[model samples]
Every structure is written in C-alpha cells, then in structure tokens.
Target chain A: MYYALQILIPLGLLMLGWGVGTLLERAHYRRIHRREDQHHHVPVTTERQLWNPDLPIAESRLVRGQVVVSVDYFKRFLAALRTLFGGEIHSYSSLLDRGRREAILRMREQFPHADVILNLRFETSTISAGGGRAMGTIEVLAYGTGVRYAQALRPPAVPDPAAD
Target chain B: MITTNIETVPGRTILEHYGIVQGSTIRAKHVGRDIAAGLKNLVGGELRGYTELLQEARDEAFSRMVDQAQEMGANAVVNVRFATSSVTSGASEILCYGTAVLVE
Candidate 1:
C-alpha cells in the first residue's frame, strides 16, 4: 500500500490543482477585464513630470497596489520538468502577467477620480518554499503619485437641494 | 501631509526642505495566516492573508514616516522611496523614506 499511496497522492493533487487553478484564473481575469473597462477615464503614466507642467493641482498624494500569487501544484511540477528542456515556461509568463495586471488594477482602483498618475514604479519579488528550485510565490508591487487638479476635488457649485 | 515620489508637486513650490526622513517596520504573519497561505499553494492563487499583512505593515511604515515629516514642520514629503527585505524566514522589513519640505 505504501507505493500505491505514494503514486496516487501526487496524481490526485495534480488533478485537483489543475481543476481549481484554472477556475480561479478565469474568474480573476473576468473580474479584471470588467474593472479595467470601468476605470478607463483614470489616466496612468510613468513619466516623472506632471502630464501638464502648468496644470493647477489642488491635491497630490501617493497611492500603491500590491499582489501575491503562487503557482498551482500541477504548474510547479510542470515547471520542474520544463527545466530539463531549458525552454520558455509559458505557465510562469501568465502567472507574472496576471500579477502585474492585477497590481496595476488595484492601484487604479485606489483613486478612481485621479486626474493622472505619475512616476509609476513596480517592485517584484519571489518567495521560495522548502528550499525548492521551483518558485513558490511572486509578489508584485506598483506605486505612483496621483494628481488632482485644482477643481478636480471640489464639489460642484450646484445649489443645495435643501435650499431648493 | 502630501507625499510624492517626484522632486516637484504639481502646483506647489518648495520653500524649504528638511533632509531625508525615514521609517521602518518589521512584521511576521501569524500561524493562522501561514497555514491558510500554505493551502493556497495547492491551486496557485493569491495569498490574501499575506497580502493583507504586508499591506498593513507598509501602511504603518508610511504613516510613521509621515508623522516624522509632520514633526519636522513640513507640509509635504517629496521624492519618496520604498524598500523591503525579508529579515528572517517569516519576518519582513519595510522601509519608507522621503525629503520633508514646506510647499507653497
């Protein structure tokens, strides 16, 4: 039973990982697409200077977003096998793309009304588990300064409804 | 206080500046969070617990830096920068620094 148990456990785990991981990734992508469409008006830029050098700014503040993603069991095993061939690992590419896009979306979500975001930066790090060669998890960080024009933050001059 | 990573604030001018101010915090996740994160590894998705933990730690560091800037009588902190490192197996350190300044 020992050898049977050993062989069956990994096989079961691989199946479970593939089934659930794909579902989660698909749901995450759907949510990301919807939110990205919702926030189209907010602009983002990596330029150090303000988009409009002379634009009046009533408020400017720092904002950031962060994400941490781990590879599923099936992908990790696949990556381990991939090392033998020494080629591009498509799984990791998508993993990193998701992390980066999610991080940026969260950053944009922080300031839905931001006129522009400037000096954008990113920081990524990997956390290895159990001293394994396979990457265990990756964290993506995105930061920037959000700018609001002089009147951007002000309430409309509409007369109060109570007064009406 | 307003914080920006760039040398200039959009509509404000720097009148005076105080040298670099810094804040640092070291944090570790609790056992419950660690266990939850481990389970997430099976299917490879976001580790929400760790995300929240790190976010809290970073916010703490940012606030501490802002407090220092306020104590220095500065209205803004510019050219802000952040760095992080894993000090130990489970604990991480977050560092935030910026130049404090009075802007008009």
Candidate 2:
C-alpha cells in the first residue's frame, strides 16, 4: 500500500507537471507565432502589383535585377518534430517571409521611384546536412528578380497566370 | 553562390577550403514515442525517425554550407547540391553544397 501510494502520488504529480509544462510551452509557441504573424510586415496590398490585375501589363527584354536572402537557424529537438507535424512550419515561413521582404525592400531602396516591379519571382529551398537522429537546423533561401516597369508601356510577353 | 573574389580568368576560386558543407542530426523520440516506435518496428512500417532526424541534419548542413560561403565572401550560392549517406543503421547525414559566386 505504501509503495503504491508513493509511486502513484509522485507519478500523478509528474503527470500534472508535464501537462502544465506542455500547456505553457504550447502557449508560448502560439504566442510567439501570433506576435510574429502580427509583426509589421509589408501590407499585402504592395504585393498585388506583382500580379497582373487586368492582363494589360506584359513586358519582355525588360531591365532585370536579382536579390538573394538566406537565413539559418537551429531548433531544439522537440521543435524539429513539431515542424513535421505542421506545428512549427509557421515560424519558418514567417522567418522566410521576413527575409524575402527585407530583400525586396532593399531592391526598392535601390530603385525607389519605380512604378511597378514586373517579372518578380521568389524561390525558397532547404537542404539537409548530417546523418544523425536529430534534425539540427533549418536554412531558408529566398531569391527573386525585381524589375521596374510600367504596365501599359511594358512589352507584350508571355501571359502565365501560374507564374505567381 | 556569390563570391567577392575577382576572377580575371579561369581558376578555382575555392569557395570553401573544406570543399563541403555538412549537416548532422540525432534524435531519440520522447520516451513514450520511443517505446511505440520500437514496438511498431516489428510490424515493419514507416518510422518517425527519418522525419525528425533528416530535418535536423538538413538544417545543420545548410548552416555550415552558408558559413563556408560567407567565409568566401559569397553573397549568394547557386547550383546547390544535396547528398545523404547512412552513417549507421539508424542514423544518417545530409550534406548540402553549392557554388559560391559573386554577383556584379
């Protein structure tokens, strides 16, 4: 009876602590995710120009520019698995988005008065490094071409809605 | 890959002296999950090991590759390559690399 009581009592306490810890961690993660999501990012309205609103803006042999941005981060073991389960993807996404935006902003800084940036393309890639049991970290690369052009004045080029 | 080195002609710029970017990962599941995985292995189905392990190694290797590129004054890496090898029965390594180049 004494053994059962000792073991059961401690086990129950452990379970309770674990549950609370999990709850706190999850809350923390969620809070961070939310704050990150809410972070002052470029308003979506800015990206709309990249999309052809009326199929009028098409250009070829246009001025071309490119920018590349990358971020490397290592997460704790548990966070790595949480990523596979779709729990931690948002964090990475946010990080990538932030990086891309900064890159674009830099481009814009280069050419501040441009009306529209045509032929804008963004690419992201990841690679694995070591043969081990735990996932060490994640590296994200974002690259794109930033162009300045006027829709009506731009040349008639390929129209691929799927480009976006 | 982008390198700041001025290559007037043809010559190996040597982006990274190591000639490799490496990422390694190790994972042991949560206690309960480990027990479950061990038991499930008997049934011969998908195991969660790869998911976690690969993710980690990939990240580490990527960081290393970037570090190497940075050391070379590369602003960007192009033509990236990825290779994997099984280090042990249950462990693996994921290495990623690319050409570091300088963009004008």
Candidate 3:
C-alpha cells in the first residue's frame, strides 16, 4: 500500500499540474490577443526617430512595463526531454511570447495621450528560486520613450483659404 | 526631471553633460509568493506577484538614478538603459543607468 501510494501521488500531481497549466495558458493567450486588438491603434516601434516627424513634441518621458512568467511542471518536463534531443522547445516559445506581449501591453496602457513609443527595447532574465535543476521564472521588460505631440500645433485637415 | 531612453530629448538643447548616473537594487522572493508562482507555473501564465516585484524594483532603481542626476544638477537623463540578472536562486538585481545632462 505504501509503495502504491507513493507512485500514485506523483502521477496525480503531474496530471493536475498539466490540466491546470493548459487552462491558464489558454486564458492568458486569449487575454493577450484581446488587448492587442484593442490597442492596435497605438504605434509601438523600434525606430530611433519619431513616427511623425512633422508633429511638434510637447512632452516625452520614459515608460516601462514588465511581466514574469513561469513554465508549468509538465512543460518543463517536456522541455528537459527535448533538451536531451537538442531541438526547439515549443513550450518555452509561448511562455516568452506571453511575457513580451504582456509587458508591451502594460506600457501602452500607461500612456494614452502619447502619439507613439520610440526606441523600444526589451530585456529578459531568468529567476530561479530553487536549485539549478528546477525550471526558473522568466521576466520580460519593455521600455520606450512616450512622445506626446503638441495639441496646439496639430495640422488642420484642410488648408484655410481665408487666412491665406 | 525629464527621462528618456533616447539619446536626445527632442525640442530641447543640451548644455552640460554630467556623465553616467546609475542605480541598482537586488530583491528576493518571499516564500508565499514563491509558492503562488509555483502554482502558476503549473498552468503557465503571468505571475502577477513576480511582475509587481520586478516593476517595483525597476521603479526604485529609476528613482535612484534620477536622484543621482539631481545631485549632479541635471534637468534630464538621456539614453537611459535597464538590465536585470539573477544573483542567486530567488534574488534578482535591477539596474538602470543614463547620461545626465542639463537641458534648456
């Protein structure tokens, strides 16, 4: 009975972790997609120069957002197995995508008035709480300069003939 | 104070350069948060606790860098950069640096 209990416990835990992990990942991806669609109008770019060079700059400030994501036990196990074979770890790809997208979304949400974000940069690192053997937490940080255009200098849609 | 990752602040003139100012902070995760993150790892999603932790650390580092700029009597910090690395199993360090400048 003792031996049977030990074998069953780990198996049960693995199964539970797998089920919950999949559900959470799906939900997170759904949220990320919805938010991305909502903020599609906000232009986020890595260009060193401003998107609209003609627009007069009113204010520019630094903005940043960060996200930390962890790999599930089941995925980690799979990743370990894949490591031995030395191939692409598909599970980790989604994990990184979620972190990066979430970080950018948070930064975008912070500055509604900004015309665009320029010089965007991303930094990622791993945080392992336990021994090196365990899967570590991954952190993604997205930062950029939020440039707000001068409202007073906004160009008119049509030329004013009377002024001319 | 004006802070930007860009090398120059648009529409502003830089008068004086104050060299590079930097700040860093190392943080360790609490047991409770670790356990929560562990559970989160099972499903594989965003770990809010760790996210908030890192955000706070970043903010602190930025503020410290700004304070250094203020000490140097600069009005802005340009070409700002951020980095992170794990010091140990649970602890990580957040570092921020920038070139301090007096702008008009």
Candidate 4:
C-alpha cells in the first residue's frame, strides 16, 4: 500500500501542474486575440496604379524594404515525419498565407505611395531529435522593398486653345 | 548603397555588405503514437526542441544574409544553403545562407 501511494502521489502532482499551465496559456492566448481584433484597420484607395503586364511576374514584394515580419509556433518532431508521407503541403497553408497578408498590410502602412518592390524571398528549415514526440517552435518571416514605379510620374498634357 | 542582384558576379573587390531573408514556423499535435513515446521518455531521452531552435536560427541567418545583400546593392539572392551544429545537449543552432548578386 505504501509503495502504491508513493507512485500515485507524484503522478497526481504532475497532472495538476500540467492542467494549471494549460489554463494559464489559454487565457494568455485569448487576451492576445482580443488585442489584435481591436487594432485591425486599413485605408481604402481606388486609383488603378498597379501595372498588369501580359506575362507573369517572377516575384512580388510583401512589404517595404528593411522591414521584417515574423510568426512563431511550436510542434512535435514525430508529427513532422507523418506529414512527409501524407505529401500534402496544405497543412502549412493557413499559417503561411496569414503571415504573408499581415506582413503586407504592415508594409502598406509604412510605405503608402510606393508601387514596386523587388528581390523578394522565402525559406524554411527544421531541427529535431531522434526521440519520440517532443515540442518545438516554428517561425515565419516576410520582407521586401517598397518603391514608387517610374511610370506613375509623367509630364501633364498642354491644352491647344487656338484650334478650338 | 546599390542593391546587387544575386544573379551575376560582381566586379573587382570583395563586397562586404550583406542582406538577410528568412522564414520560420512551428506546429504541434496530440497523436497516440507520440503520447506513447513521451511515456517511454519517462526513463530518458531527448525531446523535439531541436526543431524549434533550428527554425529560429534559420530566420536569424536569413536576416543577416538579406542585410549583406542590401549592402552589396543586389536585387536578389540565390543558391541558399542551411547548416546545423549542436551547441549543447539541450541546444542547437541552424543557419541559412546564400549568394547575393545583381540582376538587370
């Protein structure tokens, strides 16, 4: 009876700690969400300034130059392996898309009139141990230059009143 | 500083400026197999923190590369590579780097 009690006591304490930790984390997450909702805003514009070429662009900028946007999260290494066999990149779609949009919005705020940005890039990397399931973090960063396209500025046309 | 596109070799002089770009992400799951494995770790073994650490390091290195690229007046970067090394039992570092060049 004493031996059973010794084992049960430690297990119970561990479970209690895990529960409390999870509750605290959930509360923190909710507060962050509320803050983000309150801060969301964007300006509306109708001028057709964007250039549309017949051919597709090789790259596009998400934001102005010298700016960096990052998103971080954690995952288990073993779960990553399962994703490989599934062969579907969709699992990461939402995370990447949201990061891209948020970064672009921030960039627009920084460079309101800039039209063209270049040298955009994207990359990913992983670090894992050979053990069972473990916890790890993921981070996403988006960056690019912001510039006004040259064509946007041109000399105004002169009126010929004599002909009228 | 002129931006160099990573597409071509630069003229005489070892360019010192650098540009950096990077991306990172993390995910978690409660699979039965993972649960069983964690249970076994009660005896002893490393966890999955390496994945998170590597992602963070990669982002940092990419940022540095972008900075260098911008200094060199490069418009883009290419031929990127990643490397990793163990800093300690509980920590590791991952790096992502590439060549910066000029493009038309």
Q: Report the poorest 10 consecutive residues by lDDT, candidate 3 chain A.
A: A151-160
Candidate 2: where are CA atoms >4 Å away?
Answer: A1-164, B1-34, B39-49
Off by over 4 Å in 1: A130-135, A151-164
Of 1 and 4, which scores higher on DockQ?
1
Query: In candidate 4, what are the lDDT values of residues B1-104, reduced to their tens digit?
Result: 22222322222233442444433222332355345434423322222332233434555766776776776677666545445444543344555556665554
lDDT for A26 (candidate 3): 89
Candidate 4 lDDT, tens digit per residue, A34-131?
Answer: 64454333221221122333322333222421111111221122236657787654424433444444434444555555444334443332223344
Compared with the true structure, what per-residue lDDT tens digits does model 2 show for residues B34-102?
454443322222234433444456567767877877787765554444555555544445556555655
Q: Any residue pairs clashing in model 1, and if so which?
A: none
lDDT of 3 by residue, B35-92 (tens): 9887777667778998888889999999999999999999999999998877887787
- Candidates, ranked, DockQ: 3, 1, 4, 2
Best-performing candidate as measured by TM-score: 1
List model 3 lDDT by residue over A1-164, tens digit each.
Answer: 99999999778777876898888888988899999898776678898786457666899999888888887877887888898999899978888988899999999888876777889999988777676545646888999998888874433423469987
Query: Which DockQ-derived CAPRI band holds candidate 2?
Result: incorrect
Docking quality class, candidate 1: medium
Candidate 2 chain B has its poorest 10 consecutive residues by lDDT at B3-12
For model 4, the chain A TM-score is: 0.35
Q: After the best TM-score superposition of candidate 4, give how far the Cα of residue A138 lies from its true spot, in angstroms.
A: 5.8
What is the model-wide C-alpha lDDT for candidate 3? 0.85
Higher-ranked by TM-score: 1 or 2: 1
Candidate 4 Cα misplacement greater than 4 A, ranges: A42-164, B1-60, B67-72, B75-104
lDDT by residue (B24-51, candidate 1, tens digit) is 9998767887678788999988999878
